[model samples]
Target: MGRWEPNARMRLVRAAIDLCAEQGYEATTVAQVVERAGLTKATFFRHFPDKREVLFAGQEEHAALLTAGIGAAPEGVAPLDAVAAGLDALAASFSPEQHEFSARLTAAVAASPELQERDALKTVGLAAAMTAALADRGVPDPTSRLAAELGVLAVKQGFAAWADGDRDDAGALAGEMRTALESLRRAAATLG
Candidate 1:
């Protein structure tokens, strides 16, 4: 009988996540990941440079959707609204199980300072990706970049509230961000 093989990238990611979840991010090693995945060193390195990157494989996919969503946003949709809509679409794309896994991964990252930096970088990259997409769609102000960044931050926070294992429904967490933004706008108007 042939040996059963796992999907290489998926195996590596799952291995990293399992290690991080069980042993914390700093303690998890590449060998541990490969071992968990039931794969060789070569296979693990071929898929990811390190365990941290494995936790973020979905980053590129999410960025792509952000770009595409902003690019395709209907005419007359404000930039921030466009960004929020894009995020809503992204949230809609995940199934409950995927959301649960995503929540675990986010928690693992948040608990580690180094991983928090990576998450920040990922958010910056996502915002830049969205800004470029908005520019292509005719949004020409610097506010486009700021708005995109803010939108992503709000979305991230909202998603965290939703992904809370106590009761997961990140899409519903949209209200929290909406209320926050509204408050900010009101404060700005009062200052003006």
Candidate 2:
């Protein structure tokens, strides 16, 4: 293997996703993934701790984006609005190239109980990140938690819609997430 390979992380991720989709997540191994990517074990370990983490490589970066987006929001804006800003930040990180990968990751998780549990943990982690950011902004306790939940839901719903919708749609992931967040906001308003 070459000492320096560009896009090694992405190549490993794509190879893992393709292998998982082809075989099964449980049946797939780190060795197989590395082999498929034509990268050495050292390179794979440098990028991911294991095969499962390949699917969740963006978790930390995503949480940081959420926190940063909320922190950057104008002071005294509503909590949900702050969350919307966070979602915008998170969505902006995605590219058209990732659309297919998102779809495949969703499917791979759906097919495996282990991946589903990991995905759930990811959701909780994301919510915690958003909640902490909101708290730092002086959002009240229950309100911060509530807003975080809504933000997470919006991300999931919006991601699903974007991944499953027409690839040619003019609207991007940000638009879908904004729509989902607005829908949640409207629903919450109806409760009062």
Candidate 3:
């Protein structure tokens, strides 16, 4: 690939994931990522502040997508339904080809405590974004928080299934997520 390629960021991410998968995240270095990407360390730094940031460069954009999805939900929709809409929108960003990459990325994160911490923090940040979005949609206090948590759970479970499950399509992954969300709703209804 050349420097003029339109997917330098994605190339860097793929390189990083590939290197991390082969050697383990703790053992991988930025130089190796750049080399694997056929790019420069400067290019990598331009896209990401550090190696860890490579795994999380989409955080702000994803949060924006989720919030936009929530904001676009039909008026008077149920909170969890609104969350489901947002999750569906978010899942649309992941293509069928990205599933293996996602699986590799998950495995790389699992191998590094630091990467795992970053992943947790990213999840919390996303949950906080969803909570604010839900609140703006007039969802109540504990309900908004709970709804946001459940939304995050659905996304996490959906991603795991999409990355590790037998299904290959984004639509199928979204359906599986909706099923998981419904399951949560059913389980919640059983309470009190």
Candidate 4:
């Protein structure tokens, strides 16, 4: 076979996902991941803290993007409007090329209860990060938290549709997210 190329991080991620899908998440190990990636154990550690982190690597970037998006909202925008803007900004960070990877990663996450718990924590962290950003802009309590949560819901809904092969229906991840946000608003309106 050809020599393994040296993109250790990507290779490790792919290997981990492959192993988890083939065997099982709980059955997979860091050693197996490294072996599949054609890399050393040290390389895996260099990239991720542990097996769980392989699937969660994007979370830090996600939080940062959400924070930046909320922070950049135009001054004095309504809380929900600010959240919508943030969702739009964050959604713009993804491209169609990422859809397949996201779908696979999400599937891997779904296969393991531990991974699901981590995903839940990450979701809460994203909401907290967004809330902090909104609060920084003087968004009041309840408003900040509520708006941040709404944005998180929009993200979840959008990504679910996007990763579930709705690419043709939504056009793009950002568009899907915006559609989700609008749907949330409409639903909330009816509750009043």
Query: What TM-score goes with each of the models?
Result: 0.81, 0.94, 0.95, 0.88
Off by over 4 Å in 1: 1-6, 165-191
Ranking of models by lDDT: 2, 3, 4, 1
lDDT of each: 0.73, 0.91, 0.87, 0.81
Lowest lDDT 10-residue stretch of candidate 3: 91-100
**Using TM-score as the measure, what is the rank order of every candidate, best first?**
3, 2, 4, 1
lDDT (tens digit, per residue) of candidate 2 on 52-109 = 9998889999999999999999998999999999999999888776787778888999
lDDT by residue for model 3 (1-192), tens: 776678899889889988988989888899999888889998998899999999777998888878888888999999999998888888777777677688998888888999999989999988999999999999989998898888888888878877888777879878877888888888889997
What overall lDDT, based on C-alpha atoms, would model 1 receive against the true structure? 0.73
Candidate 4, residues 1-192, lDDT tens digits: the string is 112566677778777877887888899999998888888887789889999999777788888888887778789888777777777777776765467567777788888899999989999999999899999999889888888888899899888888886573324777778888889888878987
Best by TM-score: 3
Clashing pairs in 2: none
Q: Write the per-residue lDDT of candidate 1 for residues 1-192, one digit (tens) a residue.
A: 111475777767777877898889999998888788878888777777777788887788888877776666788887777776666656655555556576678868978998999988998988888888888878886877767767677667666666664544545555555544454445545865
Residue 3's lDDT within candidate 3 is 68
lDDT winner between 2 and 3, please give it. 2
- Please state the error at residue 110 of candidate 4 in Å: 2.0
Whole-model lDDT, model 3: 0.87
Quote the positional error of residue 48 for candidate 1 in Å: 1.4
Strongest candidate by lDDT: 2
Regions of model 2 farther than 4 Å from truth: 1-3, 168-171
Query: How high is the lDDT of residue 51 in model 4?
Result: 94
Candidate 2 TM-score, C-alpha based: 0.94
